[model samples]
Target: MASVAFEEIVETFDFLEDWEDRYRHVIEMGRAMEPLADAFKVPATKVDGCASQVWLMAEIDGTGPEAVYHFKGDSDAMIVRGLIAVLKALYDGRTVAEVLDTDAGAQMARLGLDEHLSSQRSNGLRAMVERVRSQAAGAAEGV
Candidate 1:
């Protein structure tokens, strides 16, 4: 899977004339996520701050110090699903150190995500970032 750039996301939205098309794009991205296995799905990993039910699982491999984030979510909100797709592309397959150092908030702002999103949606996005950051921090501490 290719990691989508902020510019690419903008171009994608621009290509679509209406919100319906944009929404379809978002849904398609969500559908692209790799499914979480039943054994990996745990309540403790669920992101509670989101209005929608969002589950995130992280696998850290010491071989190359790579971290993989697997996400599964269901929401009535289309934009939120798109936002999650963006995050999954960016953060998955990265190292804990890399994820901790990345300026995810700034990138999101540059994508105009906050401007286009409702307050609730924006909060949910931030919550996702916070959860990832927390996990990265724990891993860095060797917890």
Candidate 2:
């Protein structure tokens, strides 16, 4: 969780220098992710309104200041899973407040993802982030 570096992703994109290459890199990111267990694909973990099926689980480590939020997620579509990877890079293993503080839309724009992706993919990506924030909110409240 939060394992990928933003700078590394930026460098990879910049080096690829073509939309097709960048697109492949995104797909590879998803392919490289550790597989989510099938049990996590249950209805309770599903994120609503995505064109592709998506599931996410938020595990709060503890109740105190040291609490960390770990997220596990998956998507039926390759691109969507890559988008989930982006969200995980920004959010997972961080405290709930830290996850909430990230400006994900700005992050996407900075990555130039907004220009290359389809509207449906963009909306689905936003839905993933919204689900993460909502879960983080719940964890923060519980603490």
Candidate with the greatest lDDT versus the true structure: 2
Clashing residue pair totals per candidate (backbone < 3 A): 0, 0
What's the true lDDT of residue 62 in model 2?
78
Best by TM-score: 2
Task: List TM-scores for all candidates, in order.
Answer: 0.74, 0.90
Candidate 1 segments whose C-alpha is farther than 4 A from its true place: 1-21, 38-41, 63-79
| Pairs that clash in candidate 1 | none
How does candidate 1 score on lDDT? 0.67
- RMSD vs true structure, all candidates: 3.6, 2.3
lDDT of 1 by residue, 1-143 (tens): 23455457767777787766766787787777555566644677677778876666666655333544333544445556667778876676677777777798777765556666778777788888898888777776676
Reference-based lDDT, residue 33, model 1: 54
* Residue runs of model 2 more than 4 Å from their true location after superposition: 1-4, 64-66
Model 1 residue 53 CA deviation (Å) reads 0.8
> Per-residue alpha-carbon lDDT of model 2 for 22-78, expressed as tens digits?
888888888888768998899999988789999988888976434688888888899
